[model samples]
Target chain A: MTFVFRNNTIERFFSDGEYAFSGYDDYGAVPEAERYIWWYQVPVKYNQEQLITEVESYLRRLQWAVSQVGQAPFLILSLELLYDAGVVRGDRRLVNAIDAFNQGAWQLAAEHTNVSVVDFGAFLKQYPAAEWVDWKFYFLSQMIVSPRLAGAFGQWLQTQERALAFRRKKCLVLDLDNTLWGGVLGEDGIAGIRIDGDYPGKAFRYWQEAIRELAHAGVILALCSKNNEADVKELFAAREMPLKWEDFACMRINWSDKAANIRSIAEDLNIGLDSMVFVDDNPAERELIRQQLPMVAVPEWPAMPYLLPAFYDRLVKDYFAVYALTDEDLKKTEQYRQNAGRAQAQAAFTDMDDFLRSLEMELTISPATEVTLPRIAQMTQKTNQFNLTTHRYTVDDIQRMLDHGARIWTLAVKDRFGDNGITGLIIVTDCGAVDTMLLSCRVLGKGIEHEFLKYVLGQLKASGLEEVHALYIPTEKNRQVQDFYDKNGFLCTREEQGRKAYRLSLADWDEKRNTIYKIV
Target chain B: MEQKVLMVLRRVFKDATIDETCSQSNCKAWDSMNHLNLVVELEMEFGISLEPEEIARMVDYAAVVEIVKTKI
Candidate 1:
C-alpha cells in the first residue's frame, strides 16, 4: 500500500487509495506494508525562519524513513517553493531553505539504495508561481495546488509512477547520415560530413554529447544504420569525431530492410522488441519500423539539427528517465547476451513441454514472514498484468490480516540457470475467501503460478476447508487472467463489467500439480 | 472579446458563478499565483502582452477587460 505524507488539503487531487496524512513531520515506525512518500508542498506562510526550520526537519524525517524502510523503495517528490516571490519581497532565506531541502533529498537518495528523488520542480515550471495556488480551494479545503491543473498533475504523477517501477526503455537504436551527422553519409563522404564545425553541425555535436550522457546513465546504445560498413568504420577511426563508435553496444550497418534488421537486433540482444527506441532522420525508415515492429518506439526526427536538443529532452523524459538503477540494471546488457546463448541451447528440445521439464524447476512455498512481507505487499501494489483479484494491500494491512487469522503464502521459483525469487503470492482468508493471487510476468509463460496455486488449494483442503471462493477483477493490463479461475475447474457464479466470481468444492477439485516442478 | 476573457477566467477559477465583479480583493481564487496564471492564459488566449504596470492595474474584472481591450 502507498502512504502519502501531505502537508496541505490535497484529498480532492489524489485518489482515495493513497493514505492521506498531515501534522508533525516524522517517520516513527513505518508499517511493513506501506510504501512511504514525501509529498510536502512548499508552505506559503510569510515567516521565512519557520519555513527554513520546517524544511530542515522534513529532510530529517525523510532520512529516518529511508533508514526504516531498508530495502523497500521510498519515493520522495522534491520540494517545490510554490508561491509568488513578488508578494513576499526579496527574501533569500526562503530560497536558501528550498535549496537546502532539495540538496538534502538528493544527497540522501544518493546514499540510500531504496530512496528515489523525483524532480517536482519540473512540473512546477509548467505554470507561473503566482497562478499555482487558488485561495478559494485553499480557504475551503486547504488545497495547495490550483484545481484547474489537476488533470495535468495526474498525468505527470502517472509518469512518475512508471519511473519508480523501472518501466523504462532498455535500448536506443540510432540511424546514421543526417540523423547523427549534419549530412548524408553516402553523399558526403567521411571528410565532407558536417559533424564538428558551423551551425547545423554544432547542434549535432551537442545532441551527441547528450546521447553520451544517456549511455553513461546505463542506457544501451546501438546503431541500425543503412550505410556502407567500411565507410562507417573509417568515420569511427577518425580522431576529429565527437562521438566514438565504441559507445555503441551493437551495430547493424547493412543495406537490408530496417524491419528485418530490428528483428535481428532483438534476437541478438535477447530483449523484447517493445523495450527499444529507434531514432532515424528519414521518415521512411521510421515508418517502416513502426509498421513492421509496432512495439518499437519510433520518435519523429527534428526538421532542423538545432531542434536536436529539444528532441533529446523529449527522448529522455518519455523513455530513459528511471527513478533509480538496480544492480541487475547495470549488468542488463550482459544478461541479454546470456539470454541469447540460452535461446540457442533451448532449440535442442523437441517440444515446448520438454523444454520446460528439462529446466528442473523448484518452487518454495511458505508463510509470509518479516523477510517476505514487503515483497508480498509490493506485488499486490504493482502486479497489474497477472493479478487475479487486483486487491491492493499495504504492509500494515497485511500485518493486520495475519493478526486476524489470514494465511498468506509466497512462492519463490528457481530453474537450472537462475532463481526468480518470490515471484507469486496467494492470500487466503480464514473464512475460505481467496482474496488475492498474483505472479510476476518473468515466471508466467512457464505455468508456475498455476502449479503454485494448485498446491495451496491442496493444502487448504487437507486443513479442513470445504470450499474455496475466488474472484477475477479485470483491469486494462490483466485481460490475460480473465479465464484463469475457469481454467482451474472453478464454476463461475457471477459476471459483470469484466469482473467474474467463481467457487470450487475442495472435494471435487483436481490436485494436479505439475510433476516437473518440485514444491519445497 | 470580453466574453472570451470571462470564459477563460471562469474555467481557470473553476467557478461558474464568477462575474465582472471578480477581483483580487473580492475573489479569493484570484490570489497571487492564480493571478499570474490568469495573466498567462489571457496573454495566450488574446495573443497580447500586458505590461507589469497594466497587469498590476488590472485588479478588478472591469479593469482587466479594459486593459485587455487596449492591448488586443
Candidate 2:
C-alpha cells in the first residue's frame, strides 16, 4: 500500500485505496506502508516568520520520517509557491522559505538513496493562478487547488505513478513541417522557416526548448518526417534556432507510412515500439499511426500553433514522467550507440565467442558492504528482466540478513570504454538458499551476470557447500525472468502460484567462468 | 433547466445512476472533498462562478441543481 503526506486536498486525485494524512503541522504517526509520498504544497499564507518556522519544521518531520522508515522508497513532490503574494507584505521571505524548502528536499533526496524528488512546480505551471485557486472551494475547505482541475490532475497523477513504476517511454518520434516549426521546411526555405523570430515562431522556439529539456532529462528524441533529409539537416545547421539536427539520435525522413518509420526508429534506437511517443500536427498521420501501431502513444495535437506549451505539458505528463534516474538511464543513448558499434565490430572477428572474448570485460565481485548495500537493495527492488527471483527487499531487511549470517555479493562490470557500477547482486542464506539474484538490464546482453554467478558458485564450492536451492517468484513486471534459474542449470523442484523453486548441486556444477569476462 | 443541471451533476460526479435523493449528507462519497469536486465540475460544466454561500448550501442532489440553475 502507498501513503501520502499531503498539505492540500490531493486525496481525491490519486488511487482510491491509497492513504493520506494532513500537512506536516499535524502531528501523527507515519503509518505502516511499503511506500511513502511527500505531497506537501507551499503554504499560501504570507507570514514570513511563521512560514519559515513551518518550513523548518517540515524538514525536521521529513528527516524524522526518513530515520524511522529506513530503506523504504520515500517519493517527495517538490513544493511550489502557487499563490500570488502581491497583496501581502514581506512576500519575499515566504518565497525564500519555500525555495529553501525545495532545495532541502532535493538535497535530502541526493543524500538518501531511497528518496525521489519530483518537480510539482512543473505541474503547477499548467494552469493560471486564477484557475488554480477557487475562492469558493478554499472557503468550503482549506483545499488550495481549484476543483475544476481535478480531471486533469487525476490524469497527471496517474502518469506520475506510472513514472514512479519506471515505465516511461524510451523514444520520442517527432514530425516535421508545421509540427516541428511554424511553417513547412519543404515549402518555406531554411531561412523562411518560423522557428526563431516572432509570435508563432517564438512559441515554436519555446516548444523546441521544452523538447530539448526532455532530451537532456534522458528521453531519446527521434525524427520521422516526410521531407528531404538535407533540407531538415540545413535548417538544423542554421544558427538562428536553438534546436539542432544532431539533437536527435535517429531520423526517418523519407515519405513513408508513419507506422513503418516509427518501427524503423525503434529498431535504430534498439527500443520497443511500445516505448515510443509519436507527435505530429496532422490528424491523418496521427490517426494512421494510431490504427497501425496501437502500442505507440499518439497524443492529439492542439489545432492552434500557440497551444504548443499545453501540448508539451500533455506529452510529458502522459509519457515521460519518471520517479528517478538510474545510472543506466543516464547513459542509455550512449549504451545503445555502443551496442550498435559492438555489432559492427563483431563482423571483423571469425567467431561469436572470439568477438565476445575480444571485448576484454572484467567482473568485480565482492560481498555487499556499507558502500554497495543501496545498489544491492535497489537491484532486488528494480531488476525485473534478468532477475532469478523477484524478491523485493528494503535496506533494513538487507541489513537484517547480514546480521543473520547471509552472504550477499554485488558484481560490477567494466570494459575498455566504461564502468557499469554494481550492476548485479546475489544473496545467499546460511542454509544454502539463494534468496535473491538479480542484474540490471543494461549489462544483460554482455554475459557478465552469468560469469559473475559462476565465480560465486566456484567460491561457495571451495567453501564446502555441496548444494544450493533457489526460487523464482513471479510478478507482473518480472515475466522475463521466469526461466532464469533453468538457464543457469538449476533443476526445478516445485512450481506453485506461478513461482518455481530450483535446486542445484554445487559439487557437480560447472565451475568455469566465461572466457570473455576476466574475474578479478 | 433542472434536467440539464442534473445531467451535468451526474456526469461530473461520474455516477450515471444518480437521482434527486443523492446529496452531500446522504451519499458517503459526496462529502466536503467531493463537494469541492462537484463545485469545480459544476462551474466548468455551466461556465459560471458560484458564490461561497451557494457552494456551502449545495448539500443534496436537488439543492445542487437549484444552486446551479440560479447561477445560470
Candidate 3:
C-alpha cells in the first residue's frame, strides 16, 4: 500500500486501501512502506505571512520524511498556491513562497536517490483558480482540489506512475513529409519545404525541436517516409532543417509500405516493434501501420499544423518520458547511430569474425554496485526484448536477491563511437541458474549476448560450478527473445505453455567467446 | 420525473439497490461531495438549476424528485 503525506483531504482523489494518509500537513511518524508520497497541497490560510510559513514548514517536514523513508520511491509533489489570492494582484508573497517551496522540493529530489518531484502545478493549471478551490467542497470537506477534476488528476497520476516506473516506449518512428515539415518533400524542393517563417512552418519547427530533445534524452529516432530516398536525404542535408540527417538512428525512406519499413526499422534498431511509436500525418499510412502492426503505437497526426504542439505533448506523455536517464540512456542516440554505421560497414567484410573485429567492441562485466543498483532494477522492470526472464525488481528487491546469495553481473559495452554504459546484465543463483539475463536493445546485434553469457558462465565455472540452469518466461513484448536460451545451447529440460526451463553444463560452454569482443 | 431522479441517484451514489427510502442519513455513499454530484446530476436530468438551499434540503430520494418536479 502507498502512504501519502497530505495537507488537504485528497483521500477522495486516491482510492481507499490504495493509500493511507499522514495527518493533514503532519509529518511526525514516518511510515515504513513501499511507496511514500509527499502530497501536501498549499494550505488555504488567510494571512499571507502565515501561508508562507506553513509552506516552509511543509517543506521542512517533507525533508524529514525524505530522510526517514526507505529506499522505496519517495515522491515529493510541487505545491500550487494559486487559490483565492485572486483580485489581490499586488501580493506576490504567496506566489514567491510557493515558488521557493517548489524549488526546495526539486533540490531535495536532486540530492536524494529515491526522491522524485511530481509537478502539482502541471495538474492544477488545467483548472481555473475558482474551479481549483470549490468553496462548497472546501467548506464541507476541506477539499482544495476540485472534486470535478478528480478523474483528470487520477489520469495524470497514472501518467506519472508510468514515467516513474520507466515503462516508456524506446523509439520514435517518424513520417517525413507533412508530419515533420509543413509540405511534401517530393513535391516541394529542399528549400521549398516549409519549416520556417510561416505559421505552420514555425509550428512544425517547434515540433521537430521537441523531438530532437527526445532523441538526446535517449529516445531513438527513426525516419519512415514514402518519399524518394534522395529527396529526403537532400532535405536532411539542408543546414536549417530542425531534424538533422544524423539525428535519426535509422531510416526507411523508400516507396515500400510503411508497416514493412517500420518492421525493418525495428529490426535494425534491435527493439520490439511494440517499443516503437509510429507518427505520420497521412491517415492512410497511420491506418496501414495500425492494421499491419498493431503492436506499434500509432498516434494520429493533427490535420492542422498549428496543433502540432498539443500532438507532440501527447506523444511525450504517452511514449518518450525519460524518467531517469542512465549514462547509457543519455548517450543512446549517438551510440545507436554509430551501431547503424557499424552495421553498414559489416557488409564490406566477407568473414563474420573480421566484421565483428572491425568494430572493436569492448565488454566489461562488473558485479552490481550500490551506484548501479537503480539502473539494474530499472532494466528488469522495463527491458522487454532480449530478456531471458521478465522479473521486475525494486532496489530493495535487488538488495534482497544479493542477501539471498545471487551473483549479479552488469555488463558495460563500448565501441568506436560511444560508450554504451552498463547495458547488459545477468543474475545467477548459487545453484548456478541464470535467474535473470538481459541486454539493453542498444547492445544487441553485436553477438555480445553470447560473450556476456560465456564470460559470466566462465566465472561460475571457475568457482567450482559444474552447470547452470535457465528459464524463458515469455511476455508479449519479449517474444523476440523467446528462443534466446535454446539458441545459446541451454538444453531445454521442460516446456509448457510457452514457458521453457533449461539446464546447461559448464563443460559445454564452448569458450565461444566471439574473438570480436575484448571481454574483461 | 421520479424515475429519472432515481436513475441519477443510482448513478451518483453508485448503488443500484437505492430506492425511494434512500436519504443522506441512510446512504453511506451520499456524502457532501457525492451530494454535490447528486445535485448536479439532478439539475442536468431535469434541466433546472436547484438553489443552494434547495440542494441542501434535498436529503432524500423523494425530496430530490419533488424539488425537481417543482422546478420543471
Candidate 4:
C-alpha cells in the first residue's frame, strides 16, 4: 500500500486508487505501508515569518516521518513556493526559505537510502500559477493545487514511484527511416538523409541527442529497420548522426519481420522481450510487433517531428527512469557492448579454455546473509528469463529455506570492464537437490555460469555430498534455460510433461576449475 | 455548453445520472470539494473568470449554468 503525506487537501488529486493520503498538514502517524510519499505544497500565507517558520517545521516533520518508514521507499516531493511574490524589489526571504526546504529534502534524500526527492518543480513549471492554483477551490476545500491539474499530478507521482524502484524498460528498439531521421536512407542517400540542416532535421537531431543521453543513462539502444544494413552503416558514418554505429548494442538493420527482429534483439541482449520498448514511425510495423510480440511495449510514434521532445520525455519518464542510478547502472551500456563482443568472438574459440582466458573474469560467491537477503529475494521475484524452476522467494521465504538447511550462495561477477554484484544465485537443499538456480541475463553467455556451478559443486563435495539432484521446470518465459543442466553434464533421470529431472554423482565429479576465474 | 458542463460534472463526481436538475443539494458526490471542482470546470469550459462572490453563490447546477452563460 502507498501512503501520501500532504500539507494541504490533496484528496481530489490522488483519488485514482493509486494512493491514500494524509489530512491537511497532518504527519502524525506513519502507518505500516509498502511505500510513502511526502507531497506538501506551499502553505497559503501572507506573513513572511510565519511562512518561513511553517516551511522549516514542514521539513523537520518530513525528516522525522522518513525516519519512521524503515527501508520502504519514501518519496519526498520538493516544495514549490507557489504564492505571488508581491511588488517588492527583492523578496529573497520567502524564496530563500523555499530553497532551503527544497535543499533540505535533497540533503535528507542523500542521507537516507529509501528517501528520494521527486522534483515537483519539473511538473509545476510547465503551467502558469493561475492554472496551477484555483482560488475558488482553495477557499472551498483548502486544495492548494487546482483540481484541473490533478490528473497530470497523479500521473507524475506514479512515474516517480517507478523511478524510485529502478523498474523500467531496459532496451529501446528504434526504427531508422522517418523515426530517427526525416527521409529513407535507401532513397535519400547517406548525405541526403535529413539529420542536421532544417526544421524536421533539427527536430530529429534533438530526438537523436535525447536518445544518446538515454543510452548514456544505461538504456540499451538497438535498431530494428526494414532497410539495407550497408546503407544504414554508411548513414551512421556519412552524416553527423548523433547515434553512430557503435551506439546501438544490438541491431536488426535488415529486411526481416520486425517481430522476428525484435525477438532476435532480445535474444542478443539476453533480456526478456518485455523489457524492450519498440519505437517506429510506421504504424504497420508497430501493429505487427503488437500482434506478434504482445509482451513488447510498442508506444505510439509521434506524427510530427516537433513532438519528439514531448515523446522523448514521456518515453524516459515511463520506461527508463531510476530514482538514483547505481555505479553498476552507469556502466551497463559498456557491459552490454562487451557482451556483444563476447557473442561475436564466441564462435572463434575452439574450447571454453580459450574463451575463459580471454575474458579474464573473476567470480565472488558469498552466502546469503541478512544484508544480501532483500536483493536475493528481489532477484528471485523479478528474474524471469534465465531463472531455472522460476521459484520466487521473499526474504522471509529465504530465511525459512535456511532453517530447512538450504545453503544459498549468491554469485558476483566482474570482468575486465567492471563489476556486476550479486547477479546469480544457487540454492541447494539438505537432501542434495537444487531448489533454485538462476543468473542475471546480463552475466550469462559467459562460461561464468559453469564456473559458478562448479564452485558450488566443490562446496557440496567438501560437505560430503554423494549425489545432487536438479530440476528443469518449464515456464513460458524460461524456455532458454531448459537445456542448461543437460549441457552441464547432469544425467537426466526423468522427463515428463516438459519437466526434466537430472542427477549428478559427486563421486564422478571432475573438480576441474576454470583457470581464468579467481573464485572467492 | 450544457453537454460540456455535464461532462465535467460526471467526470469530477464519477457519476452519469447528473442533469440540469443536479444541484449541491441533490448530489451527495457534489460536496464542497467537488463543488469547487465543478466551479473550476465551468470557469475553464466557458473561458471566464469567476469572482469570489459568484463562486460562493454557485451552489447548484442551474446557478452554475446562469453564471457561465453571463460570463461567456
Candidate 5:
C-alpha cells in the first residue's frame, strides 16, 4: 500500500483504499509502505505572512520524509493555491513562496532516481480557478479539492503514475502521402507537392518539426508508403523539410501491403511490434493495420491540417512521456542507424570470419561499478531474445547481489560502426554458478556471447576454481537459446519440462578466444 | 426513484445487504468519508444540490430519500 503525507482531506480523491494517510499536517514517524506520496496543498490562511511560513516548512518536511523512505518511489505533487484569501493587490510574496516549494521538489527529483515530481498545476488548469474548492464541502469535510472532480482527478493521477513507470513505446512508423505533407508525391510530383509555401504546407511543416523532435528524444522513425522509391527520394532531396532521408532508420517505399511493410520494419529495427505507433492520414490504411496487427498502436488522425499540432500533443502524453531520460535513451536513434549500417556491411563480405575481423570489434569487460550499474539493471529488465535464465532485476536488487559478493560483469561492445554501450551482462554467484546471462540484440550477429563466456570461465580457472554450473530456463521469446550451454561443451545433467541444467568442469574447458575481436 | 437511491447506497457503501433501514449508527461502512461520497453521488445521480443542513440531517436512508424528494 502507498502511504500519503498530506495536510488536508485527500482520501476522497484516492478512494481505492490502496493508500494510507498520515495525520493532519503530519510528517513525523512515517509508517513503512511499499511507496510514498506527498500531496500538500497550500493551507488556507487570511494572513499572507503566516501562509508563507507554512508553505516554506513543507520543503524541509519533504526532504526528511524522502530521506526516511530510502529507495522507495516518492511521488510529490506540487503545491497549488486552491483558495487564495489575499485582499491586497499585486501581492508577490505568496506566489513566490509556492514557486520556491515547487522548484525545490524538482531539484530533489533531479538528485534522486526514486523521487519524481508530478505537475499538480496541469490538473488544476482544467477547471476554473473559482471552482477549485467548494466552501461548504471544505468546511464540512476539510477537503481543499472539490469532491465533484474526484473522478477526473483519479483518472489523471493514474496516467501520471503510469508515465512515471516509463513503459514508453519505442518506434514511430509514418505514412508518406498527405500524412507528412500537403499533397501526394506520386500525384503532385516534386515541385507540385505543397510542403513549404502555402497555408496547408505551413501546418505540415510544423507537424514534421514535432516528429523530428520526437526522433531526437529517442523514438525510432520509419516509413511505410505506397509511393515509388525514386519519387520519394527525389522529394526528400528537393524539399527543405524538417525530416530527411537519414532520419528514418528503415523505410518500405514500395507498393506492398502496409501490415507486411510494418512487420518488416519492426524486424529490420530489431524491436517488437507492440512497441510501435503508426500514424497515417488515410482511414482505410489505419483500419487495415488495426485489424491485421492488433499489437501496433494506430492513433486517429485529424481531418484538418491545423489540428495536427494538438494531435501531436495527445500522442506524446499517451505513448511517449517518461519520468526522465537516460544517456542510453538519448543515443538510441544513432545506435539503430548503426545497426542498419552493419547490416549493409555484412552483405558486402563473402566470408563470415572476414566480416567479423574487418569490423575491428572491441569488447571491454569490467565488474559492475556505480557508473554502469543502472545500465546493467536496465539491460536485465529489457533484453529478452538472447537471455539464458531470464531474470528481471532493478537497481536495488542488483546492489544487494553485489553486497553479497556475487560476481557481475558488464560488456561494452564497440566496433567501426558505433559504440553499443554496456549491452551484455553476466551474474554469477560466489560459488561460480551462472545466475543470469543476456546480450542485447543489436550486437548479437558477431559471436560475442561465446567469446564472453569463454573469457569468464578462463578467469575462474586462473583463480583455481574447479567446476561451473549453468541453466537454461525456457521462456516464450528465449527459445532460440535452449541449447546454448550444450553447444558450449556443457554436459546436460538434467532435462525436464523444457528446462535444462548443465555443468562444466573448468579443468577440461577450452579457453580459446576468437582472435577476431580485441578483448580488454 | 427510491430504488435508484438504494442502488447508489449499495454502490457507495460497497455493501449489498444495505436496505432502506440502513442508518449511520447501525451500518459499519457508512462512515464520514463514505457520507461525503454519498452526497456527491446523489447530487450527480438526481441532478440536485444538497445544503449543508440537509446533508447533516441525512444520517438515515429515510432522511436521504426525503431530502432528495424535495429537491427534485
Candidate 6:
C-alpha cells in the first residue's frame, strides 16, 4: 500500500486502491506503508513573503515525513510554481524559494538511499501555465494540478515508477550510412556525405550529439552498418563529428547480415539481445532484425530528417530513462568499448598474436609522479570489473603510499586506432605484495592485461625481489578477474570463497612480455 | 443529443444502467465529484462550456439535456 503525503487534493490524479492520501497539508507521522509519495504542489497565494514561507516549509515537512518512512522507496515530486503572480509584481523571491525547495528535495534524495526525486516539472511543462490550475475547479476542490490532466498525470506517474525500477535498455545498435549522418558512405563518398552543411546535415549533427550524450550517460553504442570498414574508419578519422570511432562500443561495417552482427554485438558485450535497441533508416534491415532477432527493440525510423529530434526524444523516454546512474553505469562505456574491441578482434583476427600485432600496440609503463596522482587514484575508485584487489584509493592515499616507499606504476596504452589515456595501474607495497592492480575496461579484451602484469612483474624481478605476493579479492563486479593470478602462473598459496592468495617466485617464473606491444 | 447525454452519463458514473430517465436523485454514483466529471466530459464532448448556474441546475438527466441544448 502506497501512502501519498500531499498538500492539495490530488487523489483524483493517482489511481485508487493502490494509493491512499493523507489529510490536506498534513505532515504528521507517516503510517506504515510499502511505498510513499510526497507530492506537494505550489499553493495559489497572492502574498509573496507568505507564499515563500509556505513553500520553504514544504521542504521541512517533506524531511520529517521521509524520516518517518523507513527506507520504503520514498519518491518526491519536485516543486514547480505554475502560476507565479510575482513575475508581474516584480517579486521573484517566491519563484526562487520554490526552486530552493526543489533543490532541497534533490539533496534529500542524494543523502537518503531510499529517496528519489521525480521531475514533476517535466509533466507540468507540457501544458500552458494558464491551464495548470483552473480557478473554478480550485474553488470547488483544492486540486492544484488541473483535474483535466488527471489521466495524463496517472500515465506520467506510471512511466516515472518504471524508470525508478531501472528496466532501461543497455545498448543502442546503430546503422551509420543514412542513420548517423545524411546519405550513404559508399554512394555519397567522403566529401559528398552531408553531416554539417545544410538542413538534413544539421539535423543529423543534432541527432549525433544526442546519441553521444546517451553514450556518455553509460548507454553502449554499437555500429551495425553494411559498408566498407575502411571507409567508416577514414570518415571517423577525417570528419569532425561528435561521435568518434572510440565512442562506439563495437562496429560491424560489412555486408554480412545485420541480425547476425547484432547477435555478435550482444555476445561481445555479454548482454542479452532483449537489452539491445536497434536503429536503422532502412525498413528492410529493421524488418530483418525484427523477424530474425525478435528480442531486439526496433523503433520505427522517421521518414524525414527534421522529425529526428522528436523521434530521439521518444526513443530515450521508452528505452533509456533511468532515475539515477551508479558508478558501474558510469564505467559501462569504457567496459563495452573494451568488449567491442575484443569482439572486433575475434572477427578481424584469425590469430590472437596476429590481431595484437595488427594493433601496433604501444604500452608506456612508468612510475607515478605528482602530476599522475589524481588520475591513478581515480582509476582505482572507478575501475571495478578488472581490479584484482578491488581497493579504492584517493589522491592523498596514493601520496601517503609513495611516502612509505610503495612502488606504483601507471600504464598508458596507444594502438593503431587511437590513444587510450592512462588505462592501467599497479601499486606494490614495500614488502613485495601486490597491493592493488587494475586495468580500465577500455583496454581489457586485448591481452594487454597479461602483458601489463608481465612487464610490471619483470620490473619487480629486476629490482631483486625474489618473490611477490598477490591477491584476487572477489566483488559483485570483479568476477572476471577471479582467476587472474592463477592464469598468470602464480601459485595459489590459499583459496577460499572465490578469493585467492598467490605467491609468484621471479626465480622460477619466466616473465615473457609479448613482442606484439613495444613497452617502455 | 439525448444519446450523447446518456453516453456521457453512463461513462462518468461507470454505470451502463444510466438512461434518459437517470437523474441525480435516482443514481447512486451521481455524487458531487461525478457531477463535476460529468460537466467536464459533456463540455469536451459538445465543445461548449456550461455556466455555474447551468451546472447547478443539471441535477436531473432531463435538466442536463435541456441545458446542453440551449448552449449548443
The TM-score obtained by chain A of candidate 1 when compared with the true chain A: 0.59
Best by lDDT: 5
Which 10 consecutive positions of candidate 4 chain A have the poorest summed lDDT?
A82-91
The alpha-carbon lDDT assigned to residue A296 of candidate 3 equals 90
Clashing residue pairs in candidate 2 (N, C-alpha, C atoms within 3 angstroms) = none
Model 5: iRMSD?
0.7
Q: Tell how far residue A47 is off in model 2, in angstroms.
A: 9.5
Query: After aligning candidate 4 to the native by TM-score, how far in Å is the CA of A394 from where it should be?
Result: 14
How displaced is residue A220 in candidate 6, in Å?
A: 6.9
lDDT accuracy of residue A34 in candidate 1: 60
Please compute DockQ, using alpha carbons, for every candidate against the native two-chain complex: 0.11, 0.49, 0.20, 0.46, 0.75, 0.24
Cα deviation of A262, candidate 2, in Å:
2.3
* Isolated chain A TM-score, each model: 0.59, 0.65, 0.70, 0.69, 0.81, 0.72
Question: Tens-digit lDDT track for model 6 on A1-520?
Answer: 9999988878677754588889989766678999999888888888777888999888788888888888899999888887777746666788788888888888888788799888999998899888888777777676767778888888998888777776689999999988999998898899877789789999999999999989878899999999999989999898889899989887788999998999988888888999999999999999999999998999999999999999999999889976567776888888667656656666787888888788888999999999999999999999889999989899999999999999999999988656777989999999999999999877777788888889889889889999999999999999998888889999999989888899999988786667888987
Cα lDDT tens digits, model 4, A1-520, are: 7898987887777676666777777777778888887888888887777877887787788878988889998888888877764447586877787889888888888788788888998899889867888776777678778888987888987776666676588989999999989998888888778888888899999999999999988899888999988878877877787888888888888887889889977876778998999999999998999999999989998879999999999898778875556666778777777776666556578897787677778899999899999989989998898888999988999999999999999999887756777899999998999999999887876778888889999999999999999999999999999999988889999999999999999989886886788887
Best by DockQ: 5
Using all chains and alpha carbons, the TM-scores for the candidates as numbered come to 0.54, 0.61, 0.69, 0.66, 0.80, 0.67
Tell me the lDDT of candidate 6. Answer: 0.87
> Any runs in candidate 4 off by more than 4 Å, and if so which?
A1-4, A9-24, A31-37, A69-78, A85-87, A100-167, A197-201, A300-307, A344-439, A445-452, A455-520, B1-72
Which parts of model 3 have CA positions greater than 4 angstroms off?
A1-23, A26-40, A60-78, A85-89, A101-166, A197-203, A322-326, A346-351, A360-520, B1-72
User: What value does the lDDT take at residue A315 in candidate 6?
Assistant: 93
Lowest lDDT 10-residue stretch of candidate 5 chain A: A321-330
Which regions of candidate 2 fall more than 4 Å away from where they truly are? A1-170, A176-207, A226-256, A264-275, A300-314, A317-362, A366-370, A394-408, A414-418, A446-449, A462-465, A493-501, A506-520, B1-72
Question: Candidate 3 on A214-249: residue-level lDDT in tens?
Answer: 988899999988888877776777748678988899
Candidate number that wins on TM-score, 2 or 6 = 6
Q: What is the clash tally of candidate 5?
A: 0
